[model samples]
Target: MHTLAQLRAGELSGITRLDLAEGLTEFPAQIFDLADTLEVLNLSGNALSSLPDDLHRLTRLRVLFCSDNDFTELPACLGQCQALTMIGFKANRISEVPGAALPPLLRWLILTDNRIENLPTELGERPYLQKLMLAGNRLQSLPPSLSHCHRLELIRIAANRLSELPQWLLTLPSLTWLAYAGNPLETEADAAALEGTAHIDWSALRLEQRLGEGASGVISRATWQRNGQPDTPVAVKLYKGEMTSDGSPLHEMNACITAGLHPNLIRVEGRIGDHPEGQQGLVMQLIDPSYRNLAALPSLASCSRDVYADDCRFSAEVALRIARGIASVAEHLHQQGITHGDLYGHNILLNDQGDCLLGDFGAASFHATTDNLETQALQRIEVRAFGILLGELLERIDSGLSDERRKVLEDLQRRCCQPQVLARPGFSEVVRELRSL
Candidate 1:
């Protein structure tokens, strides 16, 4: 975090990154002094509303973040920054995105929790575009030109006004992660779907050590004691109840309840009620301490792909077992009218024996399975994501299988990730293929 004093005193002249968050109300002209060296700029949590027309003087700037500000429009001068690739303006009041505001080399664009109703056609012209997050907006339709973004891998268009899913979006060759919940096109789950869930009061539970946390909530080790039942050790997730990059915590809880129970899924014991602070929470089975995430979350350079440890290696037998477990769970989820939008390896926890437990409903959403065609296509989209994970595991193999088995695995990967959206095999078929291998 760079202070205004250091910047004005020329102490931060050759810095590659600068963060100024002291309730700035206007663009500091002194920022331009480091135009020759600055590569990243963060002015978030400020009151700035606009930027100067000649803001392009920073020729080396590659990333800019102005989130939680009062800007009502995107700065058009951003397009003049030839090296710019990432632009984030989340949680602002911006309503307009002029075509001139987008840089030609753009890759990642985040505009979550804004009032934007439309996007500029120039967005489709960026060939390097990969991740596009526009959730919590008022968009009713997507520009057809976005179909030209063949490199796009992840997109979050949840909590919007759209009434239909675009065909082009479903067929994007590289699209693997997607979330479209809380939209007009989504089918609302019946309230009774949650009736079977056990209801537990917060007062009866004894909270213990912190377990973990994610974007929407924190999980903790706790003990639950029923009136006449023995005490049970469990994990409690207290929701943060904020609008996440994917969507709302309420929607995530709904999807979790609708998903019901499965062997490979983390079991939800009950719904938490009567919280001391009036917060929503879930009571779940505590996973064994021996389990760990299959891989690390995506790194900046990998963009939308998962990153594994340097020494990570899986035998062909273990790889196939992991694949079958994930495929079976995903197939069950799709059959339940749920799409595990974020199906990366990072979301899967596995024991030493390769038994898998898929968790994290943050990016999960409900889709109508009444329409067979739409349902099948949506499931196939997730198959592509699984294919990427399968390929990653295969890449780390040190040759534990026969030539024929390796060939079969490669063939399955190709079929799952085919660009012909609906033509890709579904999760059920994927499970069968893995078993056969």
Candidate 2:
């Protein structure tokens, strides 16, 4: 991050990226000095309400972020930056998104936690568009023109006012990750299983050191106090009170509660009862320290894909075990009408013996578990995500893996990721097929 003093003192010459969070109320005109080489600019956490009309002077700019600002409308001048491909205005008061305010080269757009009730059809015209985030909005419906986004892969429309799921969203050729909870259509029946869960009061717990933190909350080790027995060690997740990229923390808590338990899933003991600050949280089984993440989070260059270790390799038995465990848990989730929206390998953890756990319900959402075609389509959408996951594990297989078994896994992935969404098998079928191997 650069400072206002540095830019004014001519100390930031020829820089490609600049981040300014000085809480300014106006755009600095001196930024034009670096217009020749600046490629990325972040003016977030400011009181600024508008940008300079001549922002187009940054000819080399490709990315811009103005999150946590006071903008009520998207600056139309953004359309003039021909090289701009990514834009973020999250947590702003933006209600107006001008049809002509977007650049042709746009690929990723984030407008989360806004008051947007409608979207311009021009959004679908951007051929390079891939990732879109519109969660925590007031959208009533998605533009039908988005059906043209064949290359689009991930989207989050959670915490909206949508009355129904769009038919076109089901068939997006490349879509893998999707989150649409906290809408009007979500029914209580989807979470009926959550009713039987034990609620642990905050008074009956002894908080310990923090385990980790993520976009939605912090995980900490805690000891559950039993009145007539020994205390038990457990992990607790206290959700942050803010809107996340996926959606509200409340939504995630509900999904986790409803997810219940499976052999391969992190067992949720119960909901965190009364809290001093009225915060929402969950109590779950403590994971073993020996287990490690299957892969690292995605690098900026990899876009939506995760990054694996350089020497990562697994025997056929280990690979099959991991795949089967995930598939079984996926089948269990689907049976309960839940979809693991964020199913990347980074969310998976495994031990040396191949036992794996699928944690992180931050992006989970619920859909109809009935036999309707749309529900079936929803499951297939997740099938594509599983296909990508299977392909990743296959790529790192050890030489001892038999050629026939390798071909079997490859063929399963091919079928799961086929362009025709309906042709993909359900998670139950995926479990059966993987178990057969």
Candidate 3:
């Protein structure tokens, strides 16, 4: 174990496995000579802009954890680490990944919370690859070649710009868990097509506990079962109340109905009744073991004040995860000409696996042929609320936020919080920029 003083002195020559993660601000370049023997290097939670150019000299390196850095682009030289198996690059400024530059031995590639717009075809050629976590990238489409990875067990492409599900993905034999909630394909036509072809019996769903409650309605947990199959747990949201000074719950139902069945935006099973009390309610899939809301705690009693306070203390990894999830959901909604009137933290829910599922669409609206300036203004207010929530989370964490993340939040605030609704960034633009961040 190297002490703080030893790291500052920067004279560790034979260190094989270096773990300088917590409470570190800078990289100790003097220890670069250990490249010959170092295998596992954990330099996370640091304020570094880039890695040493000679970092590839560690040919024997395997597990490398350098997440939460300011590197705008991954060094091409990283391919030299042929022995590398696991790589963590979460919360960085990387926009494009060079597939040929990744190590062949890579099995677990964690690149969440980055601005990756596309994946290289070469990535699918890695025979040993198993888990590819690209939850928060801006990927509009994936390379069809990914089907080549026979060993891939999990591929988390949750938040992206995908408008449709590729046919090739359905044939992957080893894949058991597939989450693509924040894609535009969640629209009505696509959902119908998927439901017809996938043979997923969604009728046997039963509502469970209420997960969240908002001014417009309440969200609950649901379980769906088919004749001889096991029950599948889901998060179901019920929309209630009439159009108030805040917004209309009917508009939200319309958005969900129009947007269709997406995994990220909380799937709507069906609607109940439209009685004298207004539009009765809606049924949705349930999300369980719910985590704390990233932006703010719900005004509901189910969420304790202490839990909200603890959420405020989220680490950089957690914050990035939430941001990525929101961006994906926003992207999907924007593609469908819909806008979430309340995109704050309280509206977004996280699962135990750190996946974000947008709920409370009771305040959402569709961008029809004519853009309603009043509605747009209300949307901007929602964006501003999201900014305040992000700022509050950062303040509570009491840690240094990278300039990239800070700039992204500030831009969101300035573009969406304006008193004039027309001054706000369109839903699509916000989603794109956030994905890049």
Each model's lDDT? 0.89, 0.89, 0.61
Q: Which tens-of-lDDT digit does each residue in 105-200 have in candidate 2?
A: 988899999999999999999988888999999999999989999988989998899999888888999999998888897654344566777899
Off by over 4 Å in 3: 1-4, 8-16, 22-27, 187-437
List, residue by residue over 222-271, the lDDT tens digit for candidate 3. Answer: 77665787877765555665322233455455566766656566666666
Q: Can you write out model 1's per-residue Cα lDDT over 373-402, one digit (the tens) per residue?
A: 878788888999999988998898875878
The segments of candidate 2 whose C-alpha lies over 4 angstroms from its true place after superposition are 189-191
Highest TM-score model number: 2
Candidate 2, residue 232: Cα displacement in angstroms equals 1.2
Q: Which stretches of candidate 1 lie over 4 Å from their true place?
A: none
**Which residue window of length 10 is worst by lDDT in model 2?**
185-194
